[model samples]
Target: MHAPDRPASYAHPARLILILSLAPTVGLGIGRFAYALVLPDMRDTLAWSYSAAGFMNTINAAGYLAGALFASRMIRRFGLAASVRWGTLACVLSLALCAITGNFYVLSFARLLAGVGAAAGFVGGGALAATIAQSRPERANFLLSLFYAGPGIGILASGLAAPFVLQGFGPGSWWIVWWAMTALAVVMTIPVLLAPFHARAALTETTAVKFAVAPVVIYLTGYFLFGAGYIAYMTFMIAYIRDAGGGAAAQSAFWSLIGVSAFATPWVWRRVLALDRGGLATTIILGVNAIGAAMPIFGHSVWLLATSALVFGVAFFAVVGSTTAFVRFNYPPQAWPTAIAAMTISFGIGQTLGPIVVGAITDALGSLSFALNVSAAMLALGAVLSAFQRKVRSF
Candidate 1:
């Protein structure tokens, strides 16, 4: 009468995980990060202040915060598969909304809605991936990294297309790119909906088990700083490239390189992510991330920016996977959902303020370089804090 953790005959769990990854591909890669691609055009066409531009993502992250607050309840009520499909649908709708309207408030609303859906889809997909990852504990880190790397696919696809569309059609053509991405998100969602994610690692334990916070407080704070720092780079890097006289090709190259490097995370950090030392994996990844984020700040050389892209792209998503690894290492299977949501809440609060704060700093100081420096410093501080966290001993 008992069920297998996955289909007894499921020949390839990697294939299923790839399908599950489409949620993040839609939710993050295109739905969220693609904004960086169209920002310059939108800023020029709309005549908005840098602060106002940052508000768009700020609102999105706020919605993400709201969604993270409710994610544990939603997952417990609806199951992981339904939550992911629903969240992805929400993101698709938000993308369409962006294409049809230029009204600032409406667009903000659209961004907010996308954030809500992204958070929901992200949390659900992570849990489902975690469930799948349990099938092969030996490859746990690599498998989890594959799921987290899903966004890179989105980023790669968007980077290759969005910049060309913006450049060809000229300013005010941001809407066209949004429509293109909406279609892409739709296509991506189909695989996600079809993914076999029936395993329930934590559904029954929702009431019986509670996630502990005290042991992971330092790691959570480090994750919070990561959320704050990374967003600033992702949200504004394209604009920085444009400001520095990089053309569409340069921008595409930079963003696409990041996307390309993302695919390597699993192989590159598989060993580290397998470590049992809790936040040590995170500390190393975050240090690499901080170095990448700091690269362009020192100087925007072509090789330097490309190296930055390579380093940041590879580590950012892996840092996320490392947190999931931490949860898997320390918590029982049944507490996965609650633990992941708590981690997300900590990250959501940090990102909700990152873009806006960084934007305001850029606006006041009239130097994007200075803003990125501050962002890098936050990441470095996070790395240091995470270094001090040790593995939790379970009862």
Candidate 2:
């Protein structure tokens, strides 16, 4: 087994992982998900059609795809810790950019930049987290979940505040919300910068392992569907809440619930994430995630919508953790970055297409409900495809 890479500031692996988690907090939670919280406002203030709003996220996903394609090179050139830090820095700077202007082109560029940084940060952070987990194999599942769940803190903080900022400042105050998110992102990024990975990780990067794709194509395909499916739910669900007569308080509660449930993900799926089966862990979580996405389809009841938020939150992040566990189970440490990047690229492509497609449907139908249905169906299909994949040995 490889030696630990935890910084000297924290002797405990879990604690180090927790600090490292701040990368995703800024990269994903603030950079990626916060866009959803601000989307409705942007659409209203910018006078964007659903398609235009969706384009913003699509461009961001495009950035994510680009970043994923190059993540291995970034990791190779700069190492894990540097990639994570630089990525978070990009995200923080981008968030500040979101506040400086209402120009759609500028905002789109910010979203695109955020996606690029987020992909790098998320990919690097996941790989580094996997490395730390390697040092404590028995507790690997728990540790990995903690790292993946880092976005929940970003979600929770932003969820709790972004909605109120939008409501309190009222209407065009969306830019103010972005400033608040920027401040929060700055705070969250501090811990990630302070934590440097142990130098031993450089040993594993010497010869890059080829991306694992052919043998696990089915599993990868399922994950691609997952990427496609989940973003629709996240990107447009806030609109649904508003459509359902949910105001600022409702949005705050709903988004915050997701963040809360997201934080609880490690405990909720620890045992499932430990499974060695190629897609069994992914299947279970994706199934749960499908259920969550579908719950909002039945009616406009507050209980119904909130239930969807909770179920979706708990399972969504776990699906990401499951993919990491899949790589750890089937690939050697040297291949982790390449393999993770491959999975990310697949996921990224799916997400890249999702928002625009789903948004088009909403625009065409004049409702987000049908789009939600399509999102649920995609996830269900992903679960089915994943079920066909069984365990395989690491090379």
Candidate 3:
């Protein structure tokens, strides 16, 4: 296949891919995931019950799962550009709804819609980018890493930006944060809209044949655990830090540090992936995650919290990048997106379960220590699973 003619600066294919990918990161990260950071404020402002807040998260996760399952079909029917445009528009409108409505039910509905939009945009955009970089699979891996890195950047941006917005503007500023994020989503669409079409037509027959492999199933299981463990910490870390007697600044800084580490992950993991044994390298990464999760339980100091963020940030995205690379190495190109979607669905399932399970433990036990312990256990199990991954040619 001849390379698509490159766009001028603003609409280059790589730039479009990055922009489309960023829309989901902002939607999922700031619109959906950042809810955890602002939950205390939202609950107090709205006088929402804990169950109501929990249900909102559940709805968001359910929507994400639905979108992931349907994304491939949506892209096949609508084409990548249309899917990206509409999906991003949905996310922007959903966040706008969130900014306008104070009704808990309405806000929850908007969040659910946002999740659906984010998943479709992310999966479709990622697949488009991967297809464009088919000749340079390693570059594809790097672009996918950039795709996943969007959420971390969003989280970091929200964490730092929200506190400042609240401090300068006073209470009920969470809505303002959503409004700003919505604008960014709209801005993100411009680059994507201007870029040349990069997605090739799908090969249904070849894809169907490639989806039958057993290694894919095992890979998905491992990814599910990764989601469970990672989300447990990400969702609660800000609250956990505050509850541990750290001030708001400390909490924000901790998340920012995680973001910084996450931003540098692709560069760092290029070295990790260069190691001789791919499976063993992944196991070591998972083990680092286990230790990171356990850090808060063992120490309450601000330094310890910072250490945890660093450990988690560095290892988390690297593991995800490694998983995608592993899948691509083991499967044919046409099947990559489906394999990724399957793994993502499993991961989303685990993520949905994580917050509820951790919330229950915190409610009953009056601390997050038990939840952290469970996270550690899950990561350790993931490490064990990584060891068993059939050694494909390392990326």
Cα lDDT of model 3 by residue, 210-272, tens digit: 355464456566677877787767767776776777666786788788777877876767666
TM-scores for all candidates: the values are 0.97, 0.97, 0.87
Give residue 140's error in model 3 in angstroms.
Answer: 4.3
Q: lDDT of each model, Cα atoms only?
A: 0.88, 0.88, 0.69
Clashing pairs in 3: none
* Stretches of model 2 off by over 4 angstroms after superposition: 1-10
What are the runs in model 3 whose C-alpha is more than 4 Å off? 1-17, 49-51, 137-140, 199-210, 274-281, 391-395
Give the lowest summed-lDDT range of ten residues in model 1.
1-10
Better of 1 and 3 by TM-score: 1
Clashing pairs in 1: none
